[model samples]
Target: MDERKLPSPCVVVLVGPGAAGKSTWAGERFAGELVVSSDRLRALVGAGEDDLAASADAFDLLEAVVRQRIGRRLTTVIDTLGLDRERRLRWLALAREHGMPCVAVAFDTPAAECRRRNRERVKRIPADALAAQLTTWNRVKKELPGEGFDEVLQAATEVRVVPEAFVQADAAVRREDAAPRGLRFGLQVSSYTHKGGRKTTGEWIRQVGARAEAAGFDAIYVMDHFRQIPQVGRAWEDFLESWTTLAYLAACTERVRLGTLVTGITYRNVAHLGKIVATLDVLSGGRAVCGVGLGWFEAEHKAYGWEFPSTAERYALLEDALQVLPVLWGAGNKGFSGKVLEVPDTTCYPRPLQDNVPLLVGGSGPRTLRLAARYADAANVFGDVTRVREKAEYLKAQPRQIELTHLSTTLIGRDQREVDALVNQLRPRNQDPARYAATANAGTITDQVGRFRALAEAGAAEVMFSLPNLDDDLSPLDTAGEVISAFR
Candidate 1:
């Protein structure tokens, strides 16, 4: 049998009559860890593989293990006869539920040959029983093609398995599915730096993360800076390291993606940053988005004793960081020779759970936009609706159509008076709120929804709402949730 590789992070199911060498074929083609065999599981459960009474318990274990592996987006192979259409459908449904592409490897060995092999087993089945199973296999093989499998491969004699074919197919499928899915809402919790009325405690941050997820926000972003941005609050204020904050948030919430609004590339070494993002993705079940940009804050850079390079030099460094990131995420130990960064050999162990962690590029400058077009999966802009539309249009004009996301400071309240008060409080602190007016997508539910509709119409695929105050009561999230539900 020629060795073949199946796609990584896929669900591969083997179908054949009993004694058709499914286990042997799976062993040859897949890693032992990747193959979930019913017979092996049955043996482990104090029931011999041939114990018909143990079949029920054996299959239950198999399904549980399959679900666990698929949930992790790991490549898994099921070694089973798969002769039952009802059972096959259940597995197919599970695959679809996880957004995993299913591949069927149907064995076409002659029934007589299968029976011959069965006779040599420690517990042989009756000839009549073997014949019935073979009859079922014959019919099942014909139906496997139409059973929602993304691809079907037939194994007649020597199983010819090519793993790269599966890899390519999986990549193609993800690329097709990666298109923007309507207008997503992300919550940018910026109140960590300052106290509106109450101190921002650890408990407060956790509550913010939990409430954001519960409110159905697609992602939660935190500013990546050593000190509070001057626009958010006084430059000298409480701040958390970007990756550490994301890691903490990753534990606090399960659904909403956690990442920096835009990680300043110079903050960490390119290799280390990639590892950090990959680790976060694994921890968050693939909910980490790598939002990176050229380091923009000169004050923080100087305060941290790091040199603040010129704009051209910073952009050059940003491009180098982008070049180094993908290789660290998935590429095995290999030399990465870039103009600004060089590595003799690099390997990021424990690859991210997501096949591709999305890269969001921030900023709207022409050079920044060009780098985004070249490397980013998404582009983020913060400004009025017209400015956002213009940046989105510029990105669209580029070769790649990156997902466009708009950032805004939200101040939603239950009523107009409450919202007006919050707006007034924010206006005193923020320097250019009136100038970048559309970036403040706030007010009552109706007002916020109206703004969301306008952003969506202007080609923004997502909007990140920055709440100014962090409260244990979660009134802001409750109000945001109401507006989010309207989009649904």
Candidate 2:
């Protein structure tokens, strides 16, 4: 019989007795696609493929991976004996729910042949278990077509044993394991103080922009404040205006994107903020991302003489800004009047080089996420992996496909001793250093990579991390670049 050509973008579930060559068939047909195999996973998590005790955990992991792959719309193959009718029905129903077609291939090799194949393997199945599997397979094959497979095929031979081909399969599996999952990284320069700890200088800021660009950061972000937050240092400590710093950095760097971690909506009129981002987009050669949110720091607002509104009023104001900012960025003279602000038929001249200045909404509130889904190109979330995961899931379920970015403070050093020293130096400034110790991705280079992997797994599409010692030496930026590159 001729082999079948399975449909693209479908789940192919291989059904057969043990030692019937399901692994070899799957490897040949779906080498590049994700294959969730029970025996392979069992070997990975347990003593070997023969570890019956590991079966429960292996299949659980297999189900989770298959679901994830299906959610991603990737073609996947599950190489497992489908003698368990209940288990196969669950997978069939899942594919149906996702609108993906499912196919079943039943290996019809004789019980004696399967037993022969099993005897030649290191992880041999017992003769009685092999007979039971074959008995179950016969019943499963009869019911497969009616039980919800879109198509079914029958194979008459056990897989040919080839050691060299198995070696190649192992290598292919390794390459699949090594493929980079998508996640982008950016740098946020939290402090403006100079290298000698004396004063903020243009030279220092310019150096930062250049180094970050050269180090391969996707973007460089700054705090949208006129004075340092108390957690970073004294309120009087040096801080630069957000838009001005972005404009300066635009002139200093060529490739990296630039933006405020988030610009407070109430600091300036919404139309004026749009104009600023449009100009920065032109100046940066279309690298500006307008990250905005409801103003949170009452102290900073009081110090800058800006009116601080109640939390409810501030959210309402932000909702209005989200409505007005995009219109001002678009073509023609636009007029928008809101309770808190207004633009009276004014033309936004010298429009941004980019067609649309990408707006990133920053906040984790339900209302904020709803606003982001309605208006912004992305949303920024902050906190531990668990919070990040929860927010990511919630936002993903929202109506739009807004990008989710994680904002974090990353502390790094060459060794544990160096890391402890940095932590000790910053611990007195605020409880944050110790708090970060529990949740923030901090420590040596090796530790940071592991932490980043967890963030990616948690569904953060992009990340912006502030290095505490970015001003002291540029080496950490270089190291971070290396790590990001390697991870990608």
Candidate 3:
């Protein structure tokens, strides 16, 4: 089989019962290819032809060769008898971990035919060994696809092996595991403020955080901004910095993870920002996600005297910042040189508790989506199912693991009157009153739950409900709890 004909980034596993001629077929068909054969490795290592110990060592060597070759984008053909589902699954796991496609080629020839072929060979296997191999083969054949083989090729007999298309048969095994399963929920505390009689936001923050955790929310996110919007209240209103609040929340909460709904890359140096998040993660015991976005709100930027550039310039800076952040988090005293910002050997202490901190980017724009596709661990969008589905489809086109998260305002009420009143209070804030009215009034609890369900089914990995107010009465908090409970 010509390696060029197979998938570019893929690992093909040839599986079958004893005497199925997998080795012979691969050897003859895959000449000049990087073939990983346990038999060949065992012989080279001076492991006796029939020594089990030597075979194990040989398998390890074969795996190492396959890994090295695959890393270089070379097509590799495994010529061993992969008759155990677990053994085959290990290969699939490797493929997934390396972000490579994988396939399985199964040879399902009859027991009598396999025995005949084995008898013809000078170095024939014992009859008992062949029978055991056949039994294991039958079991794995039924289980391979479920175990994560993206493609499966069936060769019932030698006649079925067309070298030209046999390789393509294995290409069918490139299936990915179904998108992560479960009801995932996130919380966005946007209304929290310390203005107009309110002094500090910490009290409300702790309250909201506690409520969200008690309600079984998956994550609690705060808005990243230095000042309150004038439309909401006074311009000089007291506001808490997002990351500092999150650090406080990290120490206060246990079950719920903490992060910013959207952080501005322009506010702080990227490397410093990464180290701060890493420290928060360590403080939180690994319950931290870094949600970021290209900074907007020119007024706030002006007030702080932060470098607020044109939209394109900010995005360019954001892109550079995102790239530098990971390096600072992972590498000690490492400096980054980019078009926007450059640091000379600056080290940030205490890396994040998580192995790879979740990097979330929030924006519905195409540029943001592309950035998410290229760099983010997840993307956050605020829209209905239709909008979300469209964005998800766009993100899916990229060859990366980028989860989508949808954000929406949620108001739950037991009675229609209460629901109507809440909707009226929310109506003034909506840019589109009609749309808000329709969504709020058009659904029952079940109907709303179904809407969220549709969002999830349409590829939303998680949904976050932005609360109407961060009040101590906790009315919205209670309502959100009921809605979340009903959904669960």
RMSD of model 2, in Å? 13.7
Per lDDT, the best of the predicted structures is: 2
List the lowest-lDDT window of 10 residues for candidate 1: 160-169
Predicted candidate 3 versus true structure: per-residue lDDT over 181-280, tens digit per residue: 3668888776555233355456667777787888778899888988876544567766678898898888778888888878987888777787788889
Clashing pairs in 1: 4-161, 4-162, 4-163, 5-162, 5-163, 6-163
lDDT of 2 at 379: 88
Tens-digit per-residue lDDT, 1-488, candidate 2? 44343333568788999999888877764443367889888998898888999999999988998888777655678888878888788888888888877878888888878888998988688888888898888888788889868877666422211111121232323342487666788998888775555454787888888888887788999988888887677887777888998999999999988999888987887878888988899888999999999888998788778899998888888888887887887888869887776778647778888887888999998889888988888889997667889988987898778888988778776655676567666565654343444333456565566556666777888889988767657777887876576555
Tell me the number of clashing residue pairs for each predicted model: 6, 0, 8
Best by TM-score: 2
The deviation in Å at residue 416 for candidate 1 is: 1.5
Error of 2 at 144 (Å): 49
Which model, 1 or 3, shows the larger lDDT?
1
Query: Where is model 3 more than 4 Å wrong at Cα?
Result: 1-181, 193-200, 230-237, 429-444
Candidate 3 achieves a global lDDT of: 0.72
Model with the higher lDDT, candidate 1 or 2:
2
Q: Arrange candidates, best lDDT first.
A: 2, 1, 3
